[model samples]
Target: MNETRQPAHHRGRGPGRLIALVLALFVMLGLSGGTAFAAPDDAEKPPRAVWVPDSAKDLVAAMQPSWNLGNTLDAIPDEGSWGNGQTTKATFEKVAADGFRSVRIPVTWSDHQSATAPYTIDATYMARVKQIVDWALDSGLYVVLNVHHDSWMWVEKITSDHDNVMARFNSTWSQISTTFRDAPRTLVFEGINEPSFANATEAQKFQYLRELQTSFHRLVRTSGGMNANRLLSLTTPAGAPEPAFMNDLYTTIAGLNDSQLVAQVHFYSWYPFSVNVAGGTLYDAVAQKHLDDTFANIRTTFVARGIPVYIGEYGLLDYPNHFHPSRVERGEALKYYEHLNHTARATGVTTALWDPFSYLNRETLQWRDQALFDWIKSSWTTRSGTASFDKVFVPKSAPVTAKSLTLNLNGTSFRGVWQGGTKLVAGRDYTVSGTRLAFTANALTRLVGNRAYGVNATLQARFNSGLPWNIDIVTNDAPVLSNATGTSTAFAVPTQYRGNNLATMHATYADGTNAGPTDWTPYQEFNKAFSPDYASGAITLTPDFLASLREGVTATLVFHFYSGQTVTYKVTKSGTAVTGTLA
Candidate 1:
């Protein structure tokens, strides 16, 4: 979910070229003391080969099911300026109480530091970050403090500016290292988040990432105090999980001779399910295979070589306004979390969910989707190796009012139902058929007609029941559109009305011509597109759309929520533009 695309201007010669330039600059400057390029003191060095702590494996094991405080501290320009609410002490407490053992605090220091010489971070900003880190540590959570979203430093192509950028980068870390010099080992440092090499070839990008990591390792190690042997994390080239990228990273790291390193990579496999809404199901064979291949590669490339790996950020986009309309999307999102966490445990990788208040409400301290929260918790608690549930779809025109849906058990013996929600009835409304469940006629009718219906059942194992397992047989319903309003230059659909694919939307002119359901491309093709905010529940037409409207023309925008359910809002552009509520 933390896909930070490089800005267009950053593209140029790769890091290999920049390194040549950097070396030349170093020679020209002839200044060697206290810089990132400076060699470490031979006396302070641990050994020729880096000495990895015995606790490294234990640390990885403890950091299972980690959660990220994303989009909050890491917001560009300022914290909480982004849509996410300001993080409080209670935020970390809530996460830990809910069974998360680790937290990745992503913070951007670019705006908080001086752009000129020394590049000292503002004292107030540093203190605030320290307070948050202290809170996390106090809450008994492992904390990863990282240089996040520092696009100003990393996004630019290394050239004549390479020395200046590296100087600033080294200065920023020097300050950070000094500030947290005495902090406990639980406070891990991540060098960078999703470093981009916009101008580099694959080979160059890999080399550039290695250079960055090498510099980061050297700076942190030489910073003194606990940082000398701190458990540092580094990103793969572009933060990708590809075997080739990771293999290159592994090779580069081995040469670094540092054993106390954690390889951090982000996972958002299968874009159709992870980002777009066109995927069939989350637990389909294709999706599983993708995950399997990804983790397998990671395990083989990094984990097997005695290096710990962390999935610094991994999650599906489940914004209520955009992705929550389709039950398929919601179900798949939950399954993705479950499978990802389970796979993390199976392989020696720690997973951290990217929670920018998309699935959880930081303000109210409530889960936006309890089912997903429970599934994630169960995956961590039960450690169920392979868990899955049947996706129940009852047609509105079923012949019988009541029907029994069977749960498909994959060789594991079903123990018994642990918990069921209010939507399900144990005896009168439904009955169990071995591992299968039978819903009465009344229950079936309710599921068919209702907009939301589902029951979660926790099943036990006969033996070696890894974790208490739960499966949801959820009913799919047509998307609902409501509270739509519009104006001359803009039209608004309430967040609840929008669903996954805005591409399914079309505009019909009064003259019987139509436009879009536009393809997602350069983002400039269509002036008007749906932009929904899940937190605020506001869907408004962008200003670009209003400026592009033809004068003296009336058009009706039709949005297809599902196959048969379509909502339309009409707008007329006269001397002034006006609109009507969606119908």
Candidate 2:
């Protein structure tokens, strides 16, 4: 670990840094001066600051469903919403109607931040954001406020000593954190957007990220915000949650200062694999498997180690070019989304669909094409029927299980048990013959109409390790797991930055045994490569974004690795498998 390990004491912790330093001090002084790295005792589960229901559940239970927000609940809209602007409420309603518990509003803060470098959002603009917040809360949905596109701004300034960016970022949050200061525990505040540009090392980028996150906590606490225990969401270099991204997040903020934080990833892929663009054909199960495995691989790399992951943005293609489902697209996407939904549930990850208005093209707000609405519809069942007359929204007698989240099932007038049968257990069939039931946790879900929430027991486990041996460098060699003689070095992969599966860079001896570093052998990373996304002058492209398009025509790419191996292929039929590195 050439990375200098200086006394384990973080310098300049920003806001949360001081808290972390104090906690560290307590460990050094209180633990009999043992000098062992220490962490603060977990306080009694603090008040939750974010909980929300899906919009689908809301449609079934809205007081006034007349006003519809467009594809993005991000309209710099006017009244009837938050920013003095209109909203994408119709979209949010979809979230509420489903059995979701929260609404993640990805705001492009640049709209407000574009001004004199150090941005200041006016009352009119903020009112629009708050109005939407009110809508979600009023609908009993947990509201999550996060800066989305502005990650670009921070990146632009980070290198050139752009102090204004930092100032604006902090100042913006000061007011925001303070305004929602009295908000219920259901409201959440994420530090930044999908923070990164085309080129930024994972380590360096995350260092800045830590500074930003620590700032959020500092401002919130110092500002005496209401949602103090706010559930914070951390950013990866990009939306990819690869090992490098995860490690950076962990090292930078994990022990910095304690706050409710969740790791987040955006599930956007370009293969027969990514659900982002839904029209691709998955004719080859192997190709489909390869695609799906990508996400599974990512989830396991981070989540398996005990960090909760939230798939903040995932959706089948329902936009400009890919909106309409064809004979090919529908057949593929219909089952694809179902499988995606099932997979998400099985793993207990939370999901929020992108562009609610675009779920089924805006012209026809009703889901006119595709089977997303159907799949979601099947998973939910009405929980009640009575209006204000009933006084009680849902029956207190109803059962809520880890497998099933409460929802307004089907188009039923009243709420009823929507059997949590989406993901059948490994050996069990999701059948109803005599009443025995089976289910798996949905990767994606939300809470029902507004209700106070209790936090889930965090399923987390960290892997601390000892040093090992090193092995020979296999240049241009595709790792073959079948061999029992070569090394399977652990190269910590990069998340959204580029697509190399990151792992701990470890080396084993030629004898297929654990031969870690000892001066005899050294460790290294076998950097994977995909075709260049683009290049102009002295610049080169990386494999972070798999599918690249130019002039509306998507081209093929070959991924080359720093390890000297390269995989080449082209795009045919959304996800048709082409030849490349899988040699």
Candidate 3:
């Protein structure tokens, strides 16, 4: 992620000399414990003082579903330097048309500034940035402009060049705040992007980062214009979303007592799903837990405390990797985006997608992943149905074999159909009336045990609009023991099982008496009786399950996999040990 490069024009200088020169320049500019700037005359007052929203919640609410003009203006030295094309007025128009409420423009001013004292930002670069900002505002989109990826100055050890770094940071913001001082409330200023501290303890890093943010807050507030009331954003050290990092930031910045401030954090939860294509499952229990835990912490730690948080960057990148045969599955990507945005809205944390010309095709003004794009756009306007199976168990020999499924439509009525594979066989195997799906007894009996079965459907209301409304009614036939050993039982099924799969165990004695269909207590559940190896996509009975076995007893373990596929494995105990084979 490093893009550091010194200006070719500057000659070699010792580190000590450079530090002294930067410090001397800072003193000259009155930044070293002196008056930072001269008071502006009455004639220079801002034309109009925009009333910045006083509530952080309101500010975050207004910036929902934001986008980043990443790898563009934030590129070093010049726009388009990083392979991303130049920005245009039409790009902002498309972003608004695509349903983004706000835009974040990341600008790296280091390469565009004079390296010596009182580092001045280049006029041309400043004009270009202003142009983009104006375009977004004109298109009725909230805009956030921030210093980004200026690694040369802040990425080094703070102990070595703390003063020089401070000088550059203060001078840069003084210029930026002054330039946009008269801008409307729609324009927000972010202090920095992902500040890094080298060779420092967590405590030291927190203190230093807080000092930097303090400088930012002070500069923007006292820059002599409408900036005093403008909304300002500050990020924690490293821009991490961990609870500890957020708590530290909250503790440090709460001292400022500024209600107009918005807390910023970046989230890329579950790297295998978000970035690389390895070592993580999508939309599963584990992934959901991470999301829930992170957001819940932020909500309790910040949002509930009246501090609005914004996800400055979040979204999976479309990169090729060996684990996934292709780019992220469209359905999985849609689920990811929908869940994240939905949770954010519920938690009062605004979200912005980080795009580098992957999902959104900027050149053609179309989304490369249209399904993902549509899901995001429609979620803000549409109502959908939730489907679940009441009973996933399918007994191969019993006449009482029907799966009762229900779909609640939130009181909206719609025409529906049941589909399986490539055929539309609603009346053949199942019937869908209103929100109820009733599978035929014969169809349920024919379901292959130890395998996955799915009933797919779609619903379209007369008044509804947007992406196709569909659901997958999936359940497993009772798991049959696929293999057995002296002390172990194994069942094979699809790997997409939910947490509720293994909740019971039953035993049928050789004397025609039933021992139990024991309810696996949540605290001591059968799911906990086995260990899963995701890489192998299988679960093996643990010694805990083995300990429960008794000679001359046949046991059945019931569980469910993805789409409600239930499995029932039969095991025979011999000599105080259990052995099993597919039934």
Candidate 4:
């Protein structure tokens, strides 16, 4: 998901420096392979398709449970520059076998095209894109291809640089339409991804989008072959799901008078819950209501009007960083995914996960967490019961006691909790009363043998239907923090977690106003501002967070843990140096 402008913290040069270093190495080693493809005389007009095309609604419905090939062709300079590996035919095979019916391949053409009048896309890059699309098509998966990051990179300049933008846009699509003129109808053409405009009023933004989309429709229709009837998708400004954007997009498609057009929108849930900031640490009523209302509006605005809607991208904003602590709690995230899939089905919109090698391991072609993936996949067909929290945190220094958690049930009847193969005795080991599940002290003591500082045991809460909910038995203590000294660019608080997991961090000035990069909320974004490294026995304050601190002003930091413990500390940034002390 490319934003019009990245946040200051996200705009750091770490990735750019790495890309340059890697590209230089590739050149020095003479490993930059050939990109040229031998084109046949009739390459622009290949064999015609015999299969009849389905209506836009039917085609969109058939694309349920889709996936996105993100951060590949869309990667700024080249493929594999971002975390994900190069695209492979086996990747598509894996996607198909894993039950994804469609794939959205986002392509950024800026770096691969010329800056002159013709603005010809590099022949080699074009061929590579075609190869990947053909591979996905061979796997029997519907393909949605679009101009991706270029939307913000240069397309957004349409308002400021109209003629050049329009010329380049037309040339880019003309070449693309000609390249895939005879491709299968399964290969969809999306005009642009998350369209945006700079220095434009509401009227101008709407007018610009209508012009771009209409021009796209005209170019594709006149390009001949399957292009004449191919399914096309158009997104609102920034691909937001708000009503104004959706209404404008509807107006654009209706003006085109094309039944093969689908409305596209991207959803990352409510802002705070998406990134786990501003005290939105749970999937509460506000978050759930937002999902319900958004999907309901999409259905009413588009689907009911005979235009199918495609939730082009849907996932939490700060989801599943494989190398860092998850911003959102695992159980809470599970509930969000489960509810989202069910709601998507209820509203008749096809949804696609924005996977940039986070959900699936590109190197291993295996799910990073099979159990979590099971809940997501299962949610496509049925509901899953979840709990208020996944972990039962027990203080290692205190005597074991009864602990209770509220069960969501989610329309399922809760059966008893089980430890591996054996089912615990209901009344003695645990008790369930009207959505409340409590574990006896004896059961907890047995589970947390030796009071290990981490997860000691895992139990499954079974339900009459859907996947079982997992409960982790954890033994923990209030984390210990020590004073440290370092520069603002590099600083980590020495911490002894003992067992508890970090939840959120609160920052404030002496006058009680919020501090850090996001001053609007005292609760800074997890991973963005601070991250917990349990193995390293410390919590690292990100350079972005440290730099955002007000100079010569002491900011009090209150670290909150999942065990309901808060550790207070103070930090003062002076020049390039920073000092930390226990408060």
Task: Point to the candidate with the largest TM-score.
Answer: 4
Q: Using TM-score as the measure, name the better of candidate 1 and candidate 2.
A: 1
Model 1 over residues 518-579: C-alpha lDDT tens digits? 32321212113445444555556665555455675766766553223556766555554545
The residue-by-residue lDDT of candidate 4 on 226-331, one tens digit each, is 8998999998888999999889888888888998999999999989999989877889999999999999899988999999988999888858888778999888
Give the best candidate by lDDT. 4
Q: Kindly list the per-residue Cα lDDT of model 2 for residues 419-451, writing each as its tens digit.
A: 232322333312222222222223112322222
For candidate 4, the lDDT comes to: 0.86
Q: What C-alpha lDDT does candidate 1 achieve relative to the native structure?
A: 0.63
The lDDT per prediction is 0.63, 0.42, 0.63, 0.86
Off by over 4 Å in 4: 1-53
lDDT score of residue 220 within candidate 3: 94
RMSD of each: 12.9, 22.2, 15.1, 11.5
Ranking of all predicted structures according to lDDT, beginning with the best and ending with the worst: 4, 1, 3, 2
Tell me the deviation in Å of residue 53 in model 3: 3.9
TM-score of 4: 0.89
